[model samples]
Target: MNPAEGAGSLSAAVQAGLEGTGLASLSAGVRRLMDAYRSGEVPAAPVLTSAREVAAYAAYRMPATAAATGAAFAQMRRGLPGWTPATVLDFGAGTGGASWAVADQLPDAAGLTLLEQSGEAIRLGQAILAESTSGALRGAAWRRWRLELSDAAERAAVQDSADLAVAAYVLGELTERQQDRLTELVTGAAPAVLLLEPGTPAGHRRILAARARLLAAGYDVVAPCPHQLGCPLEVPGDWCHFAARLQRSATHRRVKGADLPYEDEKFSYVAAARPGVGSPDCPAGRVVRRPGQRKNLVTLDLCDRDGRATKLAVGKSKGEAYRRARKTSWGDRWDDAATG
Candidate 1:
């Protein structure tokens, strides 16, 4: 995948829906609410409260979140090329951004079950779906249900879960133990599970814990990791992350107080296939960091199929592979074909 992908440009229909919501004046206030969320001030409550907060979060975070998640989906595609998911179960589906991303990846997605604690977010999601042109998304079940790590009833209700499940940016709020429990809950709910978090030490830590549990449960990693081996980059001040850039609209700029035309969403994610699923075919390895290009050679750091890091230097004299290395960006699946 490109280090930066364009996946979540706001649709005209969505923009029009927001306009019809008559909540345009609340954008600035919602931006402040987002600031609170970033600071972790709004812990133990819904990040989105009123309709305006929902609109603000949808405008300010949806595009970047969708773009990042879409990149992760692309990686999953590379890993599990033959698997096709017909249904999606979204936990903590705020504004339904991740659900929309799922529909984008699988146009044939026939069922969507979204459970969120915030009624406000669910309402806004309904509005967005009402204006959607996709038949699959047009008919969705977005509900207001609290997702507790210890709620057996909730887990039981998800027993009749879908083929794919996603939990995006919602795990950082829990304790490590709760995160571990939630991992089992998520995997139990679907055959394929995707967990994404912000690109931070805390976020990466949560993903690492989830990865350990998924592996312990005999799950095979589909993307990001070439093999089921333990992550080798355990050094301090370093965390595995990928980046995706999305175009921001004028309303998005005003809500977030930004002047840049585009923003890069840095994220850490893990995508795993369940027990019956087979291991992914890794022709070479995955690009763990951005490739560095210089005069006569390019330096590529790869996490090989066994999940160990190897740094390779390819000079121009090496031929076509070297030429292709120059174009290999971050978050890409590099193979022997590119390693002459």
Candidate 2:
């Protein structure tokens, strides 16, 4: 489905899940949750401890999470073309935001499994997904599984065969060692893996670390990166990330106490697949930043296949290239062949 339609469906599902919820309680829960997230420290206990908190989280965070994950999924689809996962495993699934995002991309996937620790989260997730039109989502299995790095049985259980495994916005909650272990678990579960985190320097670093591990495991880089070479933005004060803009609903605005009709969800992600599973259609480069346009010139900041970040200026003299460059936005694949 198109993005607009998918978003509408997601909004409807969330609204359906939120029916009969108390707005005052939801707003209070949102404030507390926002404070915890803003503090940047991992909570020692489950964040969604009650139905009110779960409802608040679903109404407040699900849309943005889905939008960001959808953006990442879009890139993955573009890179892999005809490839589709028959089964999907979503680790740290939360309210199944990542699963919904995957459903938006591959609606016909036969199976989906969501593993989360919080029972409340699982309950709300099941309710939210039950409202989805996609059969895969409606039939998704919600498992209450805590991430324990050293538990052999747990690890084996999480390694169920699947085509794709996703862990989005959940890395921050783990220790560095746990993060590494989770990566191992996901990679063991599926040939293809996608990881996403907030678009912060620390988040980018986490993704870069996971990317290195995936490459070491012989997986091919699929999206955002055109080549398997080391990241060029690894230097201090620079990080690779992308943004997805989503419209805020009335409930969203009230919970966040924001008047803006839209919000941009910035995220850092890496999608990789084992050898022979999938390969990226190597573009000339990717637009790493917003394109700047002038009267007759467009400047694009690109991370090219050579693993270098540089700027390209397309002037009116370049004809069609200039037109395409002018229309290009951040996070777009920059194909020199198409431009020329």
Against the hidden reference, what TM-scores do the models get?
0.91, 0.95
Cand. 1 Cα-lDDT: 0.78
* CA displacement after TM-score superposition, residue 289 of candidate 2 (Å): 1.1
Candidate 2's TM-score = 0.95
Tens-digit lDDT track of model 2 for 146-238: 888688887778675799999999988788998999988988888889999989888999999899998988889888898999999899999
Model 1, span 292-320: residue lDDT tens? 98998888888888778889888999899
Looking at model 2, report the run of 10 residues with the lowest lDDT sum.
1-10
Residue clash pairs of candidate 1: none
Residues forming the 10-long window of minimal summed lDDT in candidate 1: 1-10
CA lDDT, every prediction?
0.78, 0.87
Residue 184, candidate 1: C-alpha displacement in angstroms: 1.9
